[model samples]
Target: MIQMDLEQRQSSRFVRPFQVTNHEDETFSAAFEGADVNLTGLGFFIDDPDLFLPQQRLSLRIKNEQTDEVYCLEGVEVIHLRPDDSGKYLCGCHISHVTSNQLLAHHRLVMTDAETALVSMETSKLSEFNFMEDGSELSTDESDFQEASMALNLAVSQSESNQQEVARFVQSVESIFASTQSSDMKLQDLKEEFEDFKQYLGQMNESTIAFATLAKLLAHTPAEPQDKLAWKTLISDFETRFLSEEQQVAYDFMHQGLDADEALEIAQEYLKK
Candidate 1:
């Protein structure tokens, strides 16, 4: 209960229905045909077959349920996401290029059918990334970055066949990023540490390696010019490295029926190790 606000006047509305398709891999697909609330853009409890990390951006196809009009929203950034007691994941997203306030009237309402679809979809038919389909200037670097995030999310979820190794790798990457963000560490020492571990992830496959790279990309929450360009280059590097590797891990883990606690434990053991 984060104080849901329905009177947001600065953005889009109408409880628009949506379809989230994978931009690169067709493995991941989802939709939202739910209520529209004005919580600074929109929020949906996306029934993602795969878990999405914080700050993930993807192409979102939003439609007015009644009118059947589709609005393609590219680079829809996922601001926040968490799960409830029923093993469902909720994603609060901000749709870009959707600034117009289309709906004139506002009221408290809920799209139970759409919400239910989002909350209870089969995980078997989803992946973690989506890109722009309309051929808009979707950057190569951005797509690479998203691909990396997808890999990390999939590696930790039930869909990853080799969950132990993926979790271990993700934990290490998060630990590495955490070190870089530490205030107590000397700048020179941190640089040296970064240089030492820089190629460490590069040697691994794209998805596992992205665990560190995406952290590196998202390290700048509010994105600066230089850092933005720098991160994009690095994200491209992540894809290149992934393509170079043999990728020993199989890609058959989504909706595999593994216990959530077990998967989470392997991925959360970085600090303890």
Candidate 2:
């Protein structure tokens, strides 16, 4: 394992309220309490350091109690294993391989924790300065104290805003995943409903044409409400389940007046790579 002194740490570690489970070992306990997490790695106590070798990979599930956010990391490489005085080993590991979405969520979680720590640090620093004194020289200039307090308030507000945005993004991604699964389960029913509506529309158009060609040509008829609903559901289901990220971009480009052939060609090239 790569060893380093405490002063050589690359990222600031914080004790956030989150739980982690080691999927590799069933006998490992004390998982619900939480761990020390930073931007890059996690430090958790285990029963034995001898069980883990240098550079060993582990599967872990981390859940943040405050946010109720869960991240299941499939690949994490062990950086070091140290036995503490309590007889338990402190396992240090860094995330190695994870999907794009999971990585994004993990990064956001780390950022949220780091931002909270920073806000706390700034508040503590501001508290150290004596802004008001009873007929005595202030330890810090009043204007300077005001500016520092304002800056701290602004930082706290900005951090909360960023956290809300991250939560919304994660929620939307989860909703899409749920929608995709639900759509797949009802695909056959949706297809049948769409086909039935198409047949009915065709029959009505044929009759309208037979009655009077000119009237039919001039008519601006709206689709039935049920037909519109079915069509919308089918379209949403198709786009969500079948299209890849690259293909969806190409599809949007086609609707925006780009040449269909060019869009298809670009999408194909992306898929090939």
Q: Least lDDT summed over 10 consecutive residues: which range in candidate 2?
A: 125-134
lDDT of 2 by residue, 75-94 (tens): 67788888777778888876
Model 1 CA lDDT for position 226 = 51
lDDT at residue 242 of model 1 (Cα atoms): 38
For model 1 the local lDDT of residue 52 reads: 73
Winner by lDDT? 2
Task: Give the clashing pairs for model 1.
Answer: 15-36, 23-130, 23-131, 28-126, 28-127, 159-253, 159-254, 206-242
- In order, how many clashes per candidate? 8, 0
TM-score of every candidate relative to the true structure: 0.28, 0.36
Judged by whole-model lDDT over C-alpha atoms, candidate 1 comes out at 0.41
